[model samples]
Target: MSEVSGPVRVAPREAWLLVATFLVAVAGLIYELIAATVSSYLLGDSVRQFSFVLGVFLSSMGAGAWVSRYVEEALPGFVWAQIGLGLIGGFLAPVLFFSYAWLGAVALPLFAMLVAVGVLSGMEIPLIARALKEIGAPEFRFENVLTADYIGALAASIAFPIVVIPFLGLMSASLAFGCLNLLVAGLSLWLFRARMRAVHWLAWALALLVSLAALWQSERLVSVVDASLFEDDVILSEATPYQQITITRFRDRVRLFLDHSIQFDTQDEYRYHESLVHPVLSLAPRAEKVLILGGGDGMALREVLKHDRVRAVTLVDLDPRVTELFATNPELVPLNRGAFADPRATVVNRDAWRFAEESTDSFDVILIDLPDPKNITLSKLYSREFYGVLTERLSADGLMVTQAGSPLFARQAFWSVARTMAATRNPIRPGAGLWTLPYHVYVPSFGDWGFVIAAPQQHRPRAPGLPRSLRYLTPDTWAAAQVFGSDIGPVEAEVNSIRDHALVGYYNEGWDTWFR
Candidate 1:
């Protein structure tokens, strides 16, 4: 291989080839991201799915690069590789979704698609460099090709979360990029028409036709797969920067799902929101100002506002899209009782951990209504460090509560949250530790879910008087919630911290055991 010692002028043909390299790099990385994201949405663990997808992709790229050595004809190889990539990468998300919907597992298809796209991407730059050399263009160097590839990758990294997922969604984004790959292939075919045969032209045409068709039908494809995954009619579905927000309906019953995990089913959601908010507020010494983290739906906000004493409520949730939906959607507004419109309620779209860390105001009650710690990002919210941050924002006699996972299914995880909260050192009193009360309630939509209430000082939780309209938590049910059966009783578990993330492991294990 000849290395260019000085600046070299590139011809039109060589410039186009480099341009193809950039586009292919963009499409390749996007495909890898789509695979990882789709798997994360369908499966539980985000960290594991991304790690495995990246490993398979990079390894497959290496295999493709090594195999590229055998291709004596570089231009033809490059064209064919792009065509194959366009088809496989374009349909990857739809295929994975359908496979998961029908087969109940996407492991085989997901990894297989990753390998295919990775290997094809691996061949791109090498073949491009070889083609550039073969044409005898002015002092072509491999570094120039690499520079384009890396810059294209940077463009993809920025665009994916900011533009692609938010606007195009996973399935459509994959198909759109797939179309880009085919467009490159078509350009290459036309540029090197003399070098290409009738068969090559036919393949390019067929790939383009197929990719365009898929891109046009992306929404219908998504709906079909969603119908299989969800029991009810999917009335609303959108992928936000943070997670996939889906709303499904059956008759009058509506359900909200984030990343395929059910947030609430409207028919029995009052049972959950009531159980979560009332007990903590009832136990708190003062209920003047309250802070809620991660109840974007406003259901918890509805319950908090039910207390006439709560003068101000601040709700912090990461996704603005979720807050906007519940705030504006007519179907959803009735469920949360238009809590977002309340004068005393303030909705801040930001991470719960960061909000707790930065806020200077003290709250009489803090409610952590976040999703279960199924991944690292969420696990940190359940960490001792996070709880300690919240401790700083709690008034001296204040109380906080978090919705722990199901005690019946995720027994160890529920206990882990309780243990971690109990271990949190009270900032109000240097040597004194926090006090915690673990409890569970049975909601039909979700089975035996658990909650842990903590305070800087020891205080017995009592059911405060609530309105007659309150659905689930009566004094009797609140008393019954504290009584645990032996089967779902506390189990020994490690305290989850920012360093260890022990809770996520226990959460995954316990749920996996039950479902399996």
Candidate 2:
């Protein structure tokens, strides 16, 4: 027989106690967010981190439930669980980050942290149910505890991105949630004073107070570690539901780092944006209505805006803060020349794949300026399935350009993207695609960054839209970018199709070597 039972009868006053229990449940949310973001920050890709944490947490929740069954002492179990929950959950973020630093890998730590949080988080609901059960009524109180738990979850789901992450960042947010857990614990002690021991009250009170103090200092501790990780001085660090965004400046350069990867370092950004924007725009003879994915810094927008003939430029970047900062910051604004504020632009802060699949619109040109496929989340963007969506949105004479990483560095990754697009024959069956396009790589900052200008028909060179401050690209350079030399070593890169998981492999091989 199961030891767990429903509340036979419980009063309104005890329902408020269950609400306190709900606060500890909110700690569950902190585990999910931190696990996802911390992994994406240290190791890239929100999707992989989220999936792993979710799986691990579910398993840990089961472990916690089994452990919960051993608690014969109801009030003591509930009290210690809250106190223990507060102590462990409160310290999770900083502990995990330091663990990650010491371990030099977050993949395992992320799930491990979630597992710990899940154990504590798992204890909350059952403890609340137990509390309700002890309050003279058992059968009917399960519904009320569930109702309170659900309400806490609803609040946490909304609050995590909108408030928690933004205001508190990761460490402080976890600290605050931990404090909330302690508050629930403290409140339980007060409400159930008749059943408590003196040491439990005194020891927990001191610990709860100490934890609140630690959270107050969480940002300072995190800032030190985060700043040390980058060459530039970190001026700001904030976490959104999507990613961890950091702004850093070194002398003349203003840089944006997303999930610890550089989005733009103004000093060498010309290489990324110019290489990304120009190769495609130069090949499209009558290109207009351009669709740009993931150029949030407005650097690509700066290049796209140069073409006065282009009608509408739809730049879909995931994070709004990046666009807003680039558009407004005095240092960065000149780089893009306030392109985001222009009437010809529509800035949609959304996932590009979802947007492309849902939109009824089509574009004459599409520029895929996304970051390198460093993890599963980004890997999908380089997949055949995603390219299939891009193919759907291309006009009859449309040209699509994708930033295919460094050919000299991650040659396989670059070629795999080109191969994946070629495999998207689904989009070509019904008058969908052209025969052949151009494959080019540039040496603006990093040498030989790949660009594949894809179309249904054969590649025919078009007029160039040279920028005001041109350093590397010329008529000769444009043609030269197309020619891969013998010195440019060959790599047997796997195709980055959705089913095969290609981009992640290339990214790991290429970037790991480059960093070394």
Candidate 3:
């Protein structure tokens, strides 16, 4: 009879059950990824985000696993839980984004969501593994369960950055993954309707419908929140490959914020950059080829361009968008006086470490206008290895000036840079004079900021020899600013010379006090 048809072998429904299980897993992981990224971009403190998120996620997952072991209706419980997870994670991303935009608060609600999703995610694999074993699959097929789990994770990680984030973006990506979870839930419910009680089928259907509705409305919701949070008539806001670049202006106080760290509040930025650049240049009468690392705002270029004799001003900033924004934005262009558009200056958009690594030449005066080394990337530039490359690039008689992180708040951090520099050479004295200045801008948004300057390594800084328009720098006032407190005498870590992360650790501790 029809070649004695082999008993119609429809693959065991549980095999397909495992596939649906993976879709739920994908939704949970995407929620975790989006929350972590939003927090990182908005919060500016990665260590805290990574630590808090990793802990909350793993611990919540353990709780979820514990609960799964007690699931009496393992099959229906597994299916319905998967459906609930789809509903939650599907909309979780947009929800978090709106919350941050509205409340400027995320940690509390963020952890709660993490725990919820982690619980759902935690139950998925174990329940599926049990379901398969019940369906006559060998108990030793644990390898199959593990393989299915990891391969799904691989697909998700690949899709997230490559496809989801770039094309669908955060809000759409989150909801879309949610829908995928719902689809998985629906299919599992449909295939097992005979085994599932009728009430459970209705519950799964309702969850699926709710997930789809949320997916449809997520874009509108996220767009509204993005507008509310990033408001300022948002002249320009872009997420660059390196960092988030946002520029906002209100009446006269034009501001540029990089990764939520205010780079300049134009109202009183002059106090900071002027002190940073003019002091070092005043001492060096003949500074022709100046190499600047990390002055993306073009403010330092404005100061260096004043020399007129600075034949080649090579400014290597990490973000081209920062340079471009300053160069083009009307509000910012006037602030820097279009210094980036200067033909004599060559701006290179590159990481300082990598750029320093591959450099072929030296400069007369190397001015480091880098931010505080609160993060590892900036820490690396302030490290001994980075400074070693820098030392090689300096003219033997050339002077170098680094805007060491504040002397008042970060004495250890500031002195660490000085000590780190001295550790490389013999006979370490105050390389140049030291100058401390408090920058006051009436930061309507943030409070007053302070910056400290260490004069060039070898020579004393003179007053401003150039007679042009000036706001806050003069030769006579230079020496007096270098005086330090008796507390600045010496540090405990002597061998903290080179190749260790002592400087970064000290910086984090100092900043922790500020953040606290």
Query: Model 2, which residues run further than 4 Å from truth?
Result: 1-13, 101-103, 107-112, 138-147, 358-362, 426-448, 461-468, 486-495, 512-516
Residue-level lDDT of model 1, residues 1-516, one tens digit each, is 998687666777989998998999999999999999999998878999899999999999999999999988999999999899999999999999999999998989999889999999999988998999899978677898999999999999999999999999999999999999999988998898889999998998998898898889999998998999999999999999899999999999999999999999988888899999998888887999999999999999999999988999999999999999999989899988899999999999998887888889999999999998999989999989999999999998999999999999999999999999999988877877689999899889889999999999988767667767896789999999999999999889999999999999999998889887
Give per-residue CA lDDT, model 3, range 1-516, as digits (tens). Answer: 366645534365866866765666567677787777667766555666867787888788888888898987667777777777777777676777777788877777777788888888888887877777666653336777777777777777777766676567666777788778767767777776666887877777788787778778865665476577764555665555456566777777777777657777777777677767776666664688898998988998898888877888899997777888788878778888999888888989988878877987777777888877776656777765666677667665565677776655565776677766555432123333222232212223333323333323445434457446767665544454555556543355322333566766787787678775
lDDT of 2 by residue, 1-516 (tens): 879966555556475676675676677776576666676677665677677777888788778877887888667787787777677767777777776656565556556657777776676677667766677653545776767777877888888888888777888887777787777777778877888899888979887888988887887888777766777788877776667788888787877888777767777777667767776776676677999999988878888888777889999998888777778878768878889888988899989999999998988889998888887778889887788788889887778888877777777777777777666654546644335443455544456677777775555674465666665566667766767776554455566766778678876787678774
TM value for model 2: 0.87
Q: What would the TM-scores of all predictions be?
A: 0.98, 0.87, 0.78
Enumerate residue pairs that collide in model 1. Answer: none
**Reference-based lDDT, each prediction:** 0.92, 0.75, 0.69
Kindly report which residue stretches of model 1 are placed more than 4 angstroms away from their true locations once superposed: 1-9
Model 2 / residue 346 / CA error / Å: 3.2
